[model samples]
Target chain A: MTDAAAPTRPIILEAALDAPPDLVWRALTEPELMARWLGASDIEAKVGRCFTVRPDGPVGEAPIACEVLEAEPGRMLSYRWRATAPGEAAALDTVVTWVLEPTAEGGTRLRLVHDGFPVVLQGAIRGQGAGVSTMSAVRRRQAPDLRRRGDGRAKMSSGEVIKWAA
Target chain B: MDLFDFDEAILEADILRALADPTRRAVFEQLARREMSVSELKAGFSVSQPAISQHLAALRGAGLVAERREGRFAYYRAEPQGLAPLIDWIDRYRAFWPERIDRLKDVLKDIKP
Candidate 1:
């Protein structure tokens, strides 16, 4: 809700689970446990292992593409979340981090961070584009205003004219 | 945020890619606060002037920045409205986690380890 805080603010979600850290870790890492809550995923905690997570049931968004960035048993897990579609150049690329802590009552306190406030969310996660093909179309649509200026100012400035894809 | 048009969606993707680099993101954030000429912006970073210009060019390409020429100097400033799509996108996603996590709590309570 606060934009003035930092350059890129990550989304943070927290949960206090009644289970212990090990049980919470199992739920976070085990495929079956994950399917029961999060999407279905591979349990291999090795860093750099890439996997796809499909929603447990038939109805949901497309499978999310992920690569493990770090893993600490019963403590933390982080992975890159890439949700791209066919024909898109490059789309949504965000990181999902799970941090677990043992509370005084022995329950597990978990923190989830999805970074990329402005850096990573793109058409990759939401949808796909034909890409590259639209540049000519954009130029054609913009010729009325940009070209009518008639001066080389557009060319002299910034090397190329840009539209908001508006 | 309806994003019915293909171009608009690509616009979001383009901006996302533009800001993906930490350095470039920093530059944009700096400009967002106030407009500055290339030299003024360059003083904040150790990269070569051309490297800074490249970053500015990328930011401009994505429509996240606007350049103003003041005599011999061109000043760059962030177009805050350009971030509307990103903020809107995040708003949509913000609702996702809590709902899912609530479900996760239920799952945790119902399931054995």
Candidate 2:
């Protein structure tokens, strides 16, 4: 995320990856690959596929239902996120978008954004197992592609080098 | 950015901006343990009631703290919910660890003679 300060708009969480644009794009759009990393649960992403992400605790049964918004090839993908609560309102639905850009060194700069999370669910996002697990799922799926080092290792992969340059 | 900007939902930037201040953070810290009145907050600092009010206004605007008017007293307390997103957002970055380590592994693989 560009930390230059959007000044109260939306808090952007962004990261650059060392994978090719297509690989990065696939990890986001392909259902199987997505499940390997970050699916609220197991899901298939199509223009109009509906899926549920089940939480793992005494919180009863909360299935996170979602509909795919945009799934352009190698460019962008988005979805609608909402809790399938009995009295849930339409206005409460959130949107998540993923944008991929090809960098100079053939790596993809990936941006994963969740735009509709309410001020209330902040609890879910807090290092809670579900939210953290979801984010980890996404990162792990992209790990092979990103392959960039943070703790200073001697050998750097080609993609890692490209990521550093980006 | 908005105090809840990290949340993508709530579009209240003033609240985050208000909390971004050192004085505001201090005020929040004080209010965390218990509810206190406007005058009570003012007593802890050298600034005037007007300044404290100004700070409280921003905090109130951000939803970081909510005020209840009980009779003649306006009591302020921490809105723990307001702070959760920031905590979660920061924690998400920590998820980067596994990926970073995996990247290091790939680098190691490349260097193997």
Candidate 3:
């Protein structure tokens, strides 16, 4: 049986930073500043550049392999992230987009969207089995009524995967 | 390195990959509800018996299912501990961003005029 009303939303987290948009953008793009906040990363602010964020201390030790998709200085930054592991051929890729907007009160509203996780998770897992005919039959049975909602953000509230931080 | 130094994402991905198939997921769900032997499990699905065995083997390799042999039959059941790595991976991100953002604030404050 399929879940009829299941929402396929991406995980989105937002925070209002006390810094200006430029400063917030710099913190996100600059390696030194990013390392102080995110993790030990070799991030470049330019588009199409690949980067790696190594685990720092206890936060994350597994390296995150990312490729820059969009890099607009002082505005938005988006990348595809996947955790590298040994012997896994097909790693699930999720998009992480950071949108920075300057607040009238001199703060930056940072909206972070980690998108494509639900689909990616489903796709990655679905590709593992040898029962293609059975899988496709199930997919065909379930595909008609399923529809993606606006911006794929509304479904995060109902997602059981990642519990948002308090 | 210490015993805890191993990356759990590898195991998490393996388990997710193992259960990704619709048939495998159904099989695993059935096993979760009640342990079943190959013949019993094969009866519910339309796939060949060899295919079911292959799916079970993948599940076993991923540590998501455990098997016990009794006489000529092998019974398989879902392994709950096999899910711990995936749970921990998700939990890590739950704590990761909020804490990092807090630290980012400190970084900004220190560098700001």
Q: What is the per-residue lDDT of model 3 for residues A1-166, given as tens digits with 9 covering 90 to 100? A: 0222211345667777889999998888889999998878999978899998764775335677889999989999999877756676323346789999999999998888775443212332343443334334444343433232444322232232233321
Interface RMSD of each: 14.9, 13.9, 10.9
Better of 1 and 2 by DockQ: 1
Query: What is the interface root-mean-square deviation of candidate 3?
Result: 10.9
Candidate that would win on TM-score: 3
Segments in model 3 whose C-alpha atoms lie over 4 Å from true places: A1-11, A58-60, A90-93, A115-166, B1-7
Model 2, which residues run further than 4 Å from truth?
Answer: A1-9, A40-45, A54-61, A84-92, A119-166, B1-113
Give TM per candidate: 0.57, 0.41, 0.72
True contacts kept of each: 0.21, 0.00, 0.26
In candidate 3 the C-alpha lDDT for residue A86 amounts to 64
Whole-model Cα lDDT of every candidate shown, in order: 0.66, 0.53, 0.67
Q: Which ten residues in a row have the lowest lDDT in candidate 2 chain A?
A: A1-10
Docking class of 1: incorrect
* Candidate 2 local lDDT, B1-113, one digit each (tens): 11112223232233345554666667776776567998888888888899888988887777778888989778997665555443343233234323433443344234333
Candidate 2, DockQ score (0 to 1): 0.07
